[model samples]
Target: MKINANEIKVGMLIEYKDDLWEILKTQHVKPGKGGAFCQVEMKSINKNTKLNERFRSNDSIEKASIENIEFNYLYDDEINYYFINQKNFEQVEVKKDIIGEKGKLLKENLNVDLIFHEDKAIGIELPNQVQFKIKSTDVALKGQTVSSSYKPAILENDIKIQVPPFIESGDEILVDTRTIEYIKKV
Candidate 1:
C-alpha cells in the first residue's frame, strides 16, 4: 500500500530503498517562512540501526503489509520462542531478539498477537496490560497513602515491577508492558 509521509505513524512498517524500516518518530513541519515538509526517524529492521531523513509534503512511500493473527504461546528455549497457530495449530519459532523481553510475560496457552509478513513471523505484540500478583515485597507502612512512595516488588511470574506505597506482598495489580508502568490495583 502507498502512503504519504505526512500520514506516517510511530509503529507503521514502511519499505524504503529495498529494506524494511519501522517508523520510530515523525513530524510534519511548516516553517514560518518556508514550505511544509515531513521529517521521519526510522529504525532498520534488518540492521537494527536508526536513520533520519526528510521528505517533501507530497512524497509517497510504500507501506509494508503485515498480518496480525492470534497465536498461542508454547514455550521458549535458549535461542528462540515458540508459538502455535490457533487456527491450524501449526508451530512457529521466532528469534529471541525479535521478541526480547516480551517473552517474559508468555505463559503456556496464552493467546498473543503475532505479526507476519507473508509467512514469516516478524514480531510479537503482547497485551498492553497483564495481571500479576505480588510474590514478595515489604509490608505497607501504616498511614501511607497510595501515592506516598513506590516499592519494588516481584510478580508471581518473577517480573519486577514497582507498586504503590500501600501495595504489599500478595497484592494483585495491573501492569502496563508497553511502558513497564503500574496501571492500577487489580
Candidate 2:
C-alpha cells in the first residue's frame, strides 16, 4: 500500500529503487529556510547495503508486503541456527549472520517470528524482553542506592549489561533484547 513519506517509521519495510528496504532510523527535519522533510536510513533486505534518503510529506512510498511466520527455536551448531515452523513443523536452518547478536538470546523452545519475503527468510524478531539468569556480578557497595547507579554484569548467555547494584549472581532478570538492557528482577 502507498503511504505518505512522513508516515514511515523505523522497522517498516518499504520498496525503494525496485528493492526491499527496512527502515533503520528516521528523523524529521524542518529547516528554517526550506521545506520540512523526513530523513530516513534503510538497510537492503536482499543484500548488505544501506541507503539514506530524504522525502517531503507529500511524497508517497510503496510499503513492501512481507510474510511473518512463527518459528520455534531448536538449536544451533556454532555455524547455523535451526528453527521449526510452528504451523507445518518443517525445519529451517538460518545463517548466524542473519540472526545477528540476537542469536545469543535464543533458547530451546522459544517462539520467534521469522520474516519472509518471496519465500526466503530475511530476518528474525526476538521477544521484546527475555528472562536470563545473571551469571556473575559484583556485590553492591554499602551505600549504593538502586536509583543511584548501575553495575556491569554478565548473563548466562555471556552477554554483558548494566544492572542495578542490588542484582547479584543467580538472579533471573528481564532484559530488553533489542537494547540489551536490564528491565527488572523476575
For model 2, give the RMSD to the true fold. Answer: 2.4
Q: What is the C-alpha lDDT profile of model 2 across 42-157, one tens digit per residue?
A: 99977869999999978999998889899999999979999998789899998888878789999899899999887888889999988999999988889876685999999998
Q: How accurate is candidate 2 locally (lDDT)?
A: 0.91
Each model's lDDT comes to 0.86, 0.91
What TM-score would candidate 2 get against the native?
A: 0.85
Going through the candidates in the order shown, the clash numbers are: 0, 0
The prediction achieving the highest TM-score against the true structure is 1
Worst 10 residues of 2 by lDDT: 139-148
Q: What pairs collide in candidate 1?
A: none
Consecutive 10-residue window with the lowest summed lDDT within model 1: 139-148
- The TM-score values for the models, in the order shown, are 0.90, 0.85
